[model samples]
Target chain A: MTQATRVHVAVPNAPYDVHVGEGVLQGIAAATAGADRVAVVSDREVCALHGDLRRHGVDAPMLEFDGGESIKTLGVLEEVLDFCAASSLSRSSILVAYGGGTVGDLTGMAASLFKRGLRVIQVPTTLLAQVDASVGGKTAINLAAGKNLAGTFHQPHAVFCDTGLLGTLSEAEYQSGLGEVIKTALIEGEPALAQLESISRDLGARAVTALSDTVARCVTTKARVVVSDPEERGARRSLNLGHTFAHAIEHAAGYGRVPHGIAVAVGLQLAASASERVYASSTDLGERIGRLLSAFGLPADLEELRSRYSLGAALTANALIEGLGHDKKGRVGAPEFVLMRGPGDIELGVMIAEEELRDLLA
Target chain B: MTQATRVHVAVPNAPYDVHVGEGVLQGIAAATAGADRVAVVSDREVCALHGDLRRHGVDAPMLEFDGGESIKTLGVLEEVLDFCAASSLSRSSILVAYGGGTVGDLTGMAASLFKRGLRVIQVPTTLLAQVDASVGGKTAINLAAGKNLAGTFHQPHAVFCDTGLLGTLSEAEYQSGLGEVIKTALIEGEPALAQLESISRDLGARAVTALSDTVARCVTTKARVVVSDPEERGARRSLNLGHTFAHAIEHAAGYGRVPHGIAVAVGLQLAASASERVYASSTDLGERIGRLLSAFGLPADLEELRSRYSLGAALTANALIEGLGHDKKGRVGAPEFVLMRGPGDIELGVMIAEEELRDLLA
Candidate 1:
């Protein structure tokens, strides 16, 4: 029997399996064996790269649209639904999203709302998707108001990621993958992060292995958190460590201008700095994290470059405040931010003073 | 102290709370208290009857659309999303569905997809919705091919049923409510079903008290099963007792033409008759059920209606076959209809032959 690495993501109802390996795309047919019809929702980039998956025994109709982070909007979802209706796809059918984070988020959501709900499988082509977006089942899209402003915690039936596809990504895209890998490392611990760092020298062989392993590791950490609090009411709030700051940067920079991982890279650094300044987390460790982010060719000084953003500080503050307000963690009142004391240690409902936050504004 | 009755529905992750009483519309404000914005997905009927819920201290932006079962299609959902976007509603916004089953189903689905998943509250108007549709976590809409073909099992945060609304329904609509009531009676057995027969004379009074009580009792039964299998893989199959035949009939006749409850009444009688014929169930009980359904002015015979339905044997056969295939109970193979031996005693996986099904077709 072939060795198939299985990553079980603990969602609310059941543990969903994520399979990552060589030629895993071929396994899409088997992963959704029971579904009578399969509608593959892919962007133009993925379709062009994969050479028309409908030709490859996918055995279902294909719905292709313009590919990009910008496509992950409610408008795109409407288009996808129209496609499903025009194709006569029913709830019994399965939807396979064949692309990166944006595609995964948008397609997962489209499949979710098609008939109220349906089964979806993620065929993540990007390294960022394989490690992060595809595993947790947080399907969503960006609106004009904010990034990931619309989404659901819908776990896919299965995720099939072929690491061979990573070879096709540009160096900038590959570095973006490392950004998430580092985020997982900082939160998860030194061991996984260190292992990924050591392999970064060789982008071809060792980097792919490191990326795949890190994806698995991040997924494991996320699955454990999700299983405990699938709705993010309690302990799962830690997963949003850098996301608050990240959302601010993404919105300020304008959507699609800031790649998610790059923005997250900056956000993670800011979070580390905040932990040090506000909560007395290890400043040295924060600097070490800063070094790793910069070493990975990501934006390490976003807090310092606050003036570069087009949006106002008050606007950024409100947007982040509004985003946090919508979060499931803010069940009580005036959504609280999670601050860290150190690695593996967190304080929930930590009120960050507006004066202190303003002082830290570069 | 206010005598606030909060019913806990046992669903996976977070079991929902159901509130029943007068001025429950006011309770909706409390449920969505902390939301940044509120989006109400209602139809014309509920808005007209409730007199623009916005007037009742619902300051949130409302998305009003066409009412009825037909509007539960994909096209309507797209329109709803467009409405949400145009209104500048963000992911943190609260979505409240105000109406009967169709409204609840469509809104629940819209919430599930909008921003991946948004918080949803159900304010059911009709009798069928208050007791049955709103209480259970099942949310779905009909497709061109089948009934409830596209959907999800999303439980709302809370449900409010104002018994006063049932006052406006026509006599035909009132009889339609009995269809589900009778179904619950059959599933719950002697105590629940016998209690039902007692209140048969004073249905109007009992509907406000005992009818809601019976529906809640049925909800309790299904809730227990749902807790074990939120995804509807195991014991949850029992709830689909009369649904298979009901779905077929509803699709055969135009959806709104034959009310859901009317189809269910006919379907339940047919199921009983089929059980007696195929699985050695009680012929006496089956006849009694037919009598009860007929007394309520439900359609017990389909011979005269056959020509009008345009239901070919092949269509019926495929519809039944495909419908069963979608049933979570039929995981191992072809879905078998649940045949009852008596009032409460149910037999699982009774594969009825097509010849026998054709023989019992009336």
Candidate 2:
């Protein structure tokens, strides 16, 4: 809490800051000085837990929504839009998202949509968001068909990730967030992979030092990739390592039932196995990912996840595979994936054969 | 039909060409040569009138929606998204919006939101969409509370304006588009204003040469302004010249009843009147605008429109005045007006006092 960790993501069109520390609300107040109107949007839980944003001195209206994964829908988006209109929120108005990734996603999309976009200050309050959502400008909601099927790339004006917000997160949420941290560690390579591999256990326990540093590291890693490819056309997809399989798992689980991090953790295993078969190497990459996930209380085995979710039948596996093809990241009839070559090297846009993928699924 | 007029809009972030001609469907085919997937989105009316896009040699799926004004809602947006998902429309898909501004607006927004945006080709059949909506990248849907309360600025990859399509447009719809063409001409200052004024009479009769040239000219004028300021940070506000007052008129008429172009036509006179009252000049700008509008079979007098829409007393005028204060372009208290000093000359962001504005309303 004494030291502040800051990361800057240069999206070219919209560069923003990601701050990790305690008592950072005052910093946000200073950044949004000349704004005509300031509005804070958050979920009901976060609003109740954090109280009103007015506590920071800059007075503004607090907009709250209820529900979890269900909130990421067009119906809910309209509700937020209606709230803005009722409050007379204009282009000059500033919107500060005061919750997790879902809140950030919904608010960011609203900011990008309302009058083509308003300046949004992302105040992500969850470990999952602090590392991932708060850094990249990807904002979206779930379509009835799938998660994040409907969305836009809208970068926030600034992202204030107060690590103090992590103290209140339940054990399950914190563990779920570790899935993304592990993904970042694995993708970044070398020093980070070695460092994370060493202290994966302590970080799972929410040790202040480990948690803050890991958060800053993940943000920094993602920022470097995002700055180079803001629109997800190239290197940015590396950030989605194991996400193709993960999206299918979430889709099959009916979204939120298996939290995003859990799905991603499971996705990394599938990706590792696919990598093992494709690369024709027995590098123990899958085994290392399994060990790291286990230390964090995450399910890493494909069989274990399938059993937990009752996903055994060929039909179910085929359906999940179908979801992968439907993912936004891939071109039609050309399903590509992000896979790990070894401990620290992640390869992007590796085309996977359908039958080969089927053999792995089986 | 032989010679196509091309206007290139330099958006810096994403530049595009606006091609105008009678038989330019072949040009559209050439533009979309290597696209992975081509899809046409339109209302049933356009689909029926235009027959099919296959005549241009590019066969693609046609997505349709029913209803008017009301179609520009979240319910419809979700439907279009569902269509994209069903069609497996991914990041590589090319969406051709082959209808009026509403279709272009809705489809452009869908393209922008679908996987954070796809390459959109705007084939504006209606004049309004051709000159304004398709050119500036301004996409929005009317909120129940207000018009364009929720929207985004997503530019199309290309725009094709087929003058031949105007053959099928109802007279009301065609004339309705003139409001925008007039607004652009007034703002462009010069030859555009003089040229439009000269051909005002024949153009009203659907003169092909006049319509095509005016369409090309208007597109060029808007492109110049958009290139300088793509996000409406400055000069782009001039495009909304007659739009502020027009929004109030449409809102009063319950939208679609008065028609956007008629309201804009009425809005122009109000803007001209306000300009006279504010500038304290002896310029004959208002009279020239009136003369031009009259030749096009448009009502040139404010009293004529007020009578037509049955707007009377201080209450209705005051209500619209209030709506101006709420405009996204100007600040909450001080509403700015875009006015013209003379032919080929415009004064943008002209702030008017509430009392003086009331005098015009009175």
Candidate 3:
């Protein structure tokens, strides 16, 4: 068992720890030590691949369902909450979310609303979830109007990111997580970005040690930002370095067509390009990030993204810009864009003129 | 225009003032001063009677729906959220919940969930709402399973309790509000209780000054308790004095049939009786409370409640106890009961044996 690296998220009122390593799944026992009742909600595929709670000697009820972006809806969220109610889970109970981002999102939401709120432990199974989704306290469900249009800031009791679980991810899915890793590394600046650039090949090969270190770094950066701005009121918005464009791209290409992390990869490049134009900075930030993303065999440009996903006319610049109007983070026409001056020098709530945005998209 | 009394609810992270007076509705403008957009969700009846946002010189879009316990469902809550989204309410915007408890519950729940939470200014139009629901940060929407089964602790930006609005309440509705008033007074003890007893005649006659003072007193008690324990983990349970039994009674008697406050009046009597038996105290506390409730024309006993609501065998002790199993505050078998040793001395999480509870109900 590889030694797990722990990152403490100091969110006010509900501070918790994140464990990242090869066999860190074993940490679940300690995380839920004194919980009167523990309910594990997992993706059926993940459960099939890596046994259920009993594998860790936990005698608790488990709910396994098909997990994906599609399941992040109010209906599915209600189903999860119903399962919680049926399991007779109480306030003192702990709910373990065992899956990718979708399962964690649904379970976190259910935990927040069930009897006004309950403790939740996240066991993220995917790379994207481990590096980003699992660390943030933002839990959401997509509405017909937009993705993650409705959500709550319900922090987890703990997060366990087992690098060993990444072995089962498909190559494309693995690359999807690398998208968020690059985004996090960019936002983190310094050694994190340098480290990611150096270990790009090892990460692509699914090296457990590399993955664990990267996850720990990402979580540490996220935790610091979250502690400073738990509600995303100020400094936390910087974490959305590439999310504004990524969400728009995903919406234009139709959700689930372009994996979120992949879209984020393209978004990171877009942000870098916009930064160069907006700030006129004499930095090769865009080219450097592009090279790093390309090294991991991910799309780093809009043209590449469109070709890779077979997203032809659907992902047009206008459609992507139109989709921005629905971003949960922004108001109607003047959507807040997170622009980059360089690594660690990210600007939040930057309002680019419509024509400037249009020119960049074109 | 009576002088408005401000009760500051010092909940952590988001503290707000509750303004109680005859024309306090006019305070809406200042409560939502810097909000870029203000969306008013009101009861249609209340809107027709008291006029809409225009009356307060606020130019905001309004969604007026029929407000009742039945409308406190996820569907209505969703409509309210959709309305918010349609109104383009951003994080900086304010949502004014203008109605009774149902409207407040639904609107507050929506405000907490939309865009991960927005500012909400509660303009409670009912005495029950003014005294209890509006002051507390408990936002909820009922599920098919139970009342307030899904909720969040999203404190309002401010609360406007216009005593003038209570003039429109029916005799039964006014008495229902008095039930909560009596419960609040008992929990508060001393001057609050004494003041209520003294002003009983004036309050019953809808005297504005009396109503304002009572509302302010109740809010003060609630505010103090909420400030000490915002999340209902410890001392906050004391506020749930009659709620455990009250919820069970409502469940067995069927919701909407017995107004919440009336059910609470009966529940208070049951609690007082149970306290006597459990603590073996010889205080005529139950009788005194019974007399006070009787003076307000609220049912003080199960027989009177049965006669008042024409509720037959549906309110059996066994059924009510069964309902207790589903109390959100307790475990399945042993529901937490708040028993009182005296007016000020309230005990929380008291576990009464099933037989003892049955005997008390009998």
Who wins the lDDT comparison?
A: 3
| Docking level for model 1 | acceptable
Model 1's TM-score against the true structure? 0.80
Model 1 C-alpha lDDT per residue in residues A1-362, reported as the tens digit of each score: 12346777766555688886666667776776788667788767777876656655687777777667778765666677666655555556788888888888888877776655677988888878877778767877765544665567777888887776777887667666767777776666667556656765553243555556656677777678778877666787787777666666666556766677777777777677777778654556667667776676665666433533434453355555444444333433344556666666655666666655554434
- Better model by lDDT: candidate 1 vs candidate 3: 3
> What's the TM-score of candidate 3 when only chain A is evaluated?
0.98
Q: On TM-score, who's better, 1 or 2?
A: 2
lDDT per residue, candidate 2, B139-252, as tens digits?
A: 888787778777778888889898888888776787779888888888888787888878887788878888888889898988999888988888778888888888877776
Report the lDDT tens digits of candidate 3 across residue range A75-140.
Answer: 787777778777787899999999999899989999999899999999999999999999878999
Error of 3 at A347 (Å): 1.4
Task: Give the higher-lDDT candidate: 2 or 3.
Answer: 3
- Model 2 docking category: medium
Better DockQ candidate (1, 3):
3
Q: How far in Å is the alpha carbon of B119 misplaced in model 3?
A: 0.3
Clash-forming residue pairs, model 3? none
